[model samples]
Target: MQATTPLSANSAATAPRTAQPVAARGRLITDAPTRMFHWLFALSFVGAYLTAEGERWRMLHVTLGYTMAGLLAFRVLYGLFGPRQAGLGLLWRKLGSAPAWLKSLRTAGSLTAVNWRQGQNLLMALAVVALLVMVLPLTLSGYATFNEWGVFPGEDWLAELHEFFGEAMLFVVLGHLALIGGLSVLRRKNQAAPMLTGRVDGPGPSLVPHNRRWLAALLLLAVLAYGAWEWQQSPKGLVPANAWSQVPGGEASGGDDD
Candidate 1:
């Protein structure tokens, strides 16, 4: 048997050290229900917007509008009763910090020197608050116009008010999207990923302890049931019979408005 010499300290130190591989890092920052609500709310608004102009699509448009109102109601309830991470009070506090951000802006030597992140957060909060505040009036005016309730003094005022709110909502939606895209580019990270994936890359405990997928499922089921019931209520169906006749060539032709 060959006698082996002990390894020197420098040689042992020079040998490549293999550590137990560090696991891929991530933390769940957004919960399932919040993400589901976010997408559903966005889609409801978009569907309503696209169908706003078409007579044949009026029923679908109305359904989507009602969906928005209902979704907002659910969101309000969730924000009020759910975890602290998803609270309206949190939004209000963020909005309350607006004065501080404004004060910072005033003190800054230039616009670029101002806290852009703080300003961006404030703007985002403003857009969200605007959207939430506007939904009730938007839906109410839409309902009035639909039923010819004549809630307003004149025939056209209700319609005009509805249109105005819709446009304002659209403006806020676009701003919200632009802010996300801009921040994503500037930060070299997808700002919207948290909503999309409900997680952010890092080694830390999840900010949201529970995923609350069951709540999201229940919300989805409720929306679907409502939509199905609405469809059943319409005699001609979700796609009105007028849509087929409206096509210049035939039902086969795509003259159907968005």
Candidate 2:
């Protein structure tokens, strides 16, 4: 072996350092179940709204409404007891930080300078809350109206409330789209792509390695079965003629008309 002289301090200090390799993109972030829930919720809401226009589509509307409700229930359960990143605790923490986040936004020099992760978290939390506000009232009012539950002052009143909630939900959906567009532009990334692909551009181990897609399939099948059962149980006519027996003048009017 050749003998080498000891390097001087300045020589060692000025030596070229090996740079660590940059991490590549395509890290899994959102889980398959959550992604399925997101898309199902969107499609069900749209279907319900579209079918709400005519009595001919009333059964379809009711089925879609029930589907939406079931999806929301599943989502709530998942958020409470699901994966680490998809839990309610994390969302709550993000929502709680909104005040500080907004204050920081006032000082942020640009979109790139802002804490995009926290900003995205805050927006997602707000969107969840907003969607709940829209969906809960819509589902409840629609169900009561359809089933003639009589929980409201009148069926007509419940119908009006259902219409109002539907309109409000449309507005909320528009706002949600606008927010997504703005965030996508600001972050210089397609925000919706992760929802579709369950992946994001980052370097990290997947939050969901296996995705447990079978669980999502099972949940979806159960919801569909419940919806089918509900549809079959619903009255085929506008109102079951026998349902009018309790009303004083209803039976008399029907008999006279007959």
RMSD of each: 5.4, 13.0
lDDT tens digits by residue: candidate 1, 1-258: 999999999999899889888776479888999899999999999989988996778999999999999999998999999998988898899899989888987798987888888888888888888989999999999999999885655458888899999999999999999998998898898989999899888777889989999999999999999999999999756776556565687656445543
- Tell how far residue 132 is off in model 2, in angstroms: 2.6
lDDT of 2 by residue, 117-183 (tens): 8877688778777886578889999988888776545338888899999998888788888888988
Scored against the true structure, residue 139 in model 2 reaches a CA lDDT of: 93
Can you give the lDDT of residue 92 in candidate 1?
A: 94
Candidate 1 local Cα displacement, residue 128, angstroms: 1.3
Provide the lDDT at 73 for model 2: 85
Error of 2 at 234 (Å): 5.8
User: Candidate 1 local accuracy as lDDT?
Assistant: 0.89
- What lDDT does the true structure give each of the candidates? 0.89, 0.80
Query: Where is model 2 more than 4 Å wrong at Cα?
Result: 1-25, 105-117, 149-155, 227-258
